[model samples]
Each structure stands twice: as structure tokens, then as C-alpha cells.
Target: MPTASVKLAVIIVSYCNVDDVDRCLKSLGRSDWDHFEVFICENGGEAAYGKLLTALVGADRTLQRASDGASALDRPHKRLASVTKCRFQNSAIVVRLGLATENLGYGGGVNAWLEPLLGVLGWDSVLVLNPDTEVERRSLSELIAKSAEGFGMVGGSLVFDSAPDKIINYGLHWSRTTGRVIAIGRNAPVGSAPSSDDLARIDAISGACVLATRSFVEDVGLMAEDYFLYMEDLDWGRRRGKYRIGFASKALIRHVGGTTIGSAVAPEKRSHLSIYLSARNSILFARRFAGWRWICHFGVGLLFAARYVLKGSLSAGRIALAGLLDGAKGKTGRPDVAPRPH
Candidate 1:
């Protein structure tokens, strides 16, 4: 197939963040990339589907609702969602929406949204994007080109939207010993390219923007859902069989990250969901791949939890500690905790 003729499925999973989704669609207004389809899931299940539908199709114009196929999206939950089809604002970008019956965490939501079409022949590459980010005009095109170079998976250059010229990270470094992740190019100036040393250390790409070819998914399977929210990208990276990871430095992306699960940008205001998941998944991930070093991994994880207590974030501290304990006991799925004010 001509690389340009390859169909791309752009997947965005949202959690009732209608405004964020709206802004994301608006960013694509200037994009000239055609032959792509945008698939969305309102995992929030608060009728954000209706709002997103209005946002994409516009109130003045109505488009036919394409049967979303979420009713058949398989999981134990067997979630059924209302799906819609529309054209994005001022662009040829096509969109499909899924109103989830329940709140599936980030990883699960992606599976729920894209599961129905995973085997369909319409697309050869899939770009999983977070709704809280805006793609630069050439980002997708750049990502597509990089995939054509034979990388099964590719990640775009992500920058903090708050400071557009500062790098968030080119990719991520997940430590097996500590079971923690550090961004490879974090806080560096945006224009500088990642050095060979930096690229060598990147074990995983940020889930904020990922492009995977059909073969990669068929080989590795859908992204792991065991962690639910955090650490899934690293988990996926660890499972990639023989495929190489690629970076599209010119595919600049602006990310306002951690929008769902109330993961705030400020560490002090960390949400219970964020703290618990991050702390717990560190243990889960380590157990799967860290071998006998899992003990040291948990120790480092506890120290991380201690920082929250030292900083006087009592709720977050408690949540993190509980998460560490739960993860050690082989607990999975959502934690049994109430939402704390972040």
C-alpha cells in the first residue's frame, strides 16, 4: 500500500471533558492531513457524548449517527455506548463518538472505544491520543512518515502547553530497579533534538501520543489494562516482541496532561486516584518484570509515598501508602477509596 494511502485511525479517549475535546478538535482545523478517522469515547458516561457530538458537528448542522459499535465492545463489563459520526470543524477530519455506559479507566476506555474496529480493514495505523492535548498541524503526518520507516510504534515530541517552548519529554525512561519513570528530555529547550544517549535510555513512549501499526497491535495485543491508568505505556513497551520504537521529533505536541483521575499538575494537589494508581502500579509493574529486584523496587516506592507525607499532603500520603500495600497484596482494579479534594 502507498504509505500516503494508508488509512489512519486517530483515537481519543475522553472523560467528560467536553471543553478539552472541543479545543483538541479545534487544533486540527489547520491540519491538511486527510484519509484519517477520529474515534472517541466519552468514558465519563455523563452524556458528554451529546456535548462532544454538538462540538464536532456544530449545533446548526446535523450529521447522521453512525452505529458506534460500543454495544459489542467486549470486556467483562460488556459496555454499551451511543456512537455518533460527524465532520470536524472547518476540516475534512471525520469523527466517531462512543458514549460509554460506564467509566472505563484510560487503558480500558481505549480498548472499549477501538476494540470493535481492531480487526477491521479500514485502517493500517492507529494513533492513540489523550483528549487533553492539541496536535500540531504536521504532527500526525510526521508520525505517519516515521512509522513507514518500519517502526512498529512511534511517539511524537511532546511539550508542555503551559510553556510551549519547554519539552515535556521526547519519550520516557522506565527503571526496572526503582520501578519509576522519568521523562527522557524533560524540561529541556524544545528545539534541541534528543542525543543518542537520551534515545538509548527511552524504554517507552508517553501514552499521551502513540502511533502503532496494525502488526504491532496484533503482535503485542491491546495495551494492558491491569494497571488501569498509570504505567500502561511502559507495560506495552516491555511486551513489544521484535518491533523497534521510533521518535518523530518534528511531530510537536502540546499536552495539558493528567486531565482524568484528577491528577493535578501541582504535586501538592495530587488526587487520591492519581497517587494511589501511580504508587500501586509501580509495584505491579516491578513484580511482572523486575524479578528478585522487586523488593528494592517496593522500598523505593515506599520512599516516594513518604515524600507526600513529608510535604504535608496527608490525603495523598495515605492514599499512596494504601496503594503500595494493596499492590503488594496482589490487589488490582480501582481502589476502595473516596475522592479527595485535589
Candidate 2:
């Protein structure tokens, strides 16, 4: 088959994690298909950190044929090239060091700066990757291939940081039968190899590593800005039926989850915010576009809330319930800063 003529532009929104940024850049060097450019949007730092990052990751070096240096992220990069069959022939450059004056959370930060740039450049696809993740060599090729198969949004499997053998996410699943939200291939150890055909038909894909077409962005718009952090992906996913969201089993990214937003162990407010936004926006999303069957969506969310409470996340469960109520009441919460764990 002939290779598709789509050019890709990668957008990574960075927040206070320089090491991860370095690793992420290193992984980009391993991309199997390289007709792409990358834009790193850094938020929540003084200029110094971004400059230091650039120095370490070759920001000053002019874009040329891909070369090598002694950075730790580079060694594995070289190994990737030796093993992978796909060509990493990307022409890449760090256009500018983007540092926001203040934090814009996730959705706000990415949308404000990157969307306009993507629109102007006319890239066929825009990949929004978490700074904490590293892509495998075939990652881009797989995403491109799957998108070519008719999915507007393409997501890959995420391996756990501590146990690279373990799969953190395969894709997102919606259970119309149970109203439950499920993640495909969760906690399955790597090399286990779940069927790619299953992932191709998933209900959604997490935003941690998603490749979306320009049409997806223009139609759905940047994630609902009101969501700030959580559920923005789910919101985007729900809208995807209009364009058909899908998963790319061949593409892979490893994520060090909970680096930015702490997990359930985080403080009450932090945990609460995650639950709140997830619940509220999910309901808001279902209500707005779920058509006449929203009652089913509501029922499923309630059951999902019960599971959280049963799991001993009482506060988080309460927040989820409250968010549902708020969404039902059409209450729009202000974007607030919840403390991050140390």
C-alpha cells in the first residue's frame, strides 16, 4: 500500500516537568514516520527552566537530518531505529520556546496557544501527547494508519512507568449494556498482546496520547474550556461519534501516570476536583449530545459513582455525586486551583 500524504504536527503541553520533556523529545527521535514538526508549550515556569530544557534537548541546534548526542534519552532512541522497520524520516525543529505567563491548566493551555498554530500550519493531523510519556518507534505510523481507516481520533496503549510490562491503558470503552465506562486492556502486562481488532472499535481513547485530525478539532473545537483538566478527553471522546473515534493498537506510549495530577492518594481537594470535573462534564456531555437516551447515560454514571464509594473513596464519590447534581442543575463551576501533591 502507498503511504498516506498526511503531514503531522505534534503539540505537547508541558507543566513543570523538565526531565519528562527531555525523555519525550528523545522518544520523538524514534518515530517510525517523520513527516512532522513539534511544538512544545510550557506552562508554569520562569524562562530559565525552558531555556535549560532547550539547551539539553538541542533547541539551539538548527533542524537538519536527525543526529545524536550523549543525552540519556538518546541511547534507547538509537536502539529503536535499529529494530524498527518503519522510517523515522521526520523533518523536525523546535520552532520557539513557548512559556505561558501563568498556568492555563490542560485544555485551556493547549487550546489557547497550539490550536491557532495548528490551524495556520494546515497540518493534516495534530498529536497531543503528555510530556510524561515516551512513544515507541512505530507509534506515529500506527496512528496514521488507523486514522486512515476512518477514525478521527487515534489513541495508543500506555505502559506503566514502574512496570513497563504492564499496560496502563489500551483505549476507552463505553458499555451501553451496563452504562459503565471501561478502559480496554487495563493492567494487562506488556507482551500479552490483546487483539488490535478489539481496540479499533473502542468507545474512546484517553488524551494522554491521542492523535486527532484537523477536522476533529474544527468540528468539536478544543476540549470544553470549562473542564480545565479532567473529563476534557471524555468530552472530546463523546463528540467523536460524530466523526468516529478509534484506537490504534500498533502505536504505543509509556506514561508515568499521576505525575501532574496526583492519583487517589492526593489531597481531598485535588481528588475532589478530578471526581467533580469527571462527573459534571460527563453529565453535561451526555445531556447535550447524548440525544434521547441520556437517561441511560445518567444511570451508568450513578453506578460508576457507587463503585468509587464502595472502593473507599468516600470523598471522591461524594464529589462525583455532587458534580452530577450540579450538572443536572446546569451549575457551572469556576475554574479553581486545587493544590498538587509534593
Count of clashes, each model: 0, 3
Pairs of residues clashing in candidate 1: none
- Global fold similarity of model 1 (TM-score): 0.91
Once superposed on the true structure, which residue ranges of model 2 sit more than 4 Å away at CA?
Answer: 1-5, 45-92, 175-180, 189-201, 264-272, 290-325, 331-334, 340-342
RMSD per candidate (Å) reads 3.1, 8.5
Clash pairs for candidate 2: 32-87, 34-90, 165-190
Tens digit of per-residue lDDT, candidate 2, span 267-323: 333455666766776666666666656577777778767877787667666777887
Judge candidate 1 against the unseen true structure and give its global Cα lDDT, from 0 to 1.
0.77
- In candidate 1, stretches whose alpha carbon ends up further than 4 angstroms from where it belongs are 59-78, 89-92
